[model samples]
Target: MNSFFHDENVALYRKLIAENESNPSRDEDRHAMLLTLLAEETAKAKQLPRLPDAW
Candidate 1:
């Protein structure tokens, strides 16, 4: 997968989490699910190859 997509997904997950927390009637289950997904996605993103500064 492309790093760009991974970054986008991470950003989206963060946004969703924020929204869920602020919601008056948020589902705990959904919040947990989103947090889990965000952690997994962040791990995957970190595993992606990094380009050298010269690049």
Candidate 2:
């Protein structure tokens, strides 16, 4: 679950980077939204506790 969230956050950052590269002047509002999303995903990843198992 944590890995999933981490992957998603990385994907989002990549998307934002692509968009910014295409449109050199990205709006401040869009940047803020991306930052907020990244923060939320990071928090969620941190909150997830380690799981114990043997297979």
Candidate 3:
């Protein structure tokens, strides 16, 4: 529940959003990046044991 983790997640989420928005046609590169970000977030969430209250 720290600002650092919150900021990091927000940044990642923003990147995903930007990537998606930049390519509304579902480009392969965009999809792959989104999936990679999702997987990374999932792994981080799982490894954290407990998610931040703010998240």
The most accurate candidate by TM-score is 1
Put down candidate 1 lDDT per residue, 1-55, tens digits, no spaces: 3787999999999999999999999999999999999999999999999666575
Q: Where is model 1 more than 4 Å wrong at Cα?
A: 52-55
Ranking by TM-score: 1, 2, 3
lDDT of 1: 0.94
Cα lDDT for residue 5, candidate 2: 64
lDDT tens digits by residue: candidate 3, 1-55: 5445745875787777677778758677766777777677656765655655774
Listed per candidate, the RMSD to the true structure in angstroms reads 1.8, 3.4, 4.6
Model 3 lowest lDDT segment of ten? 46-55
lDDT for every model? 0.94, 0.73, 0.68
- Please give each candidate's TM-score: 0.87, 0.58, 0.47
Give the per-residue lDDT digits (tens) of candidate 2, residues 7-39: 678687768856865786788787777777777
- Which structure is stronger by TM-score: 2 or 3? 2
What is candidate 2's local distance difference test score? 0.73
Candidate 2 deviant stretches above 4 angstroms: 51-55
Top-scoring candidate (lDDT) = 1
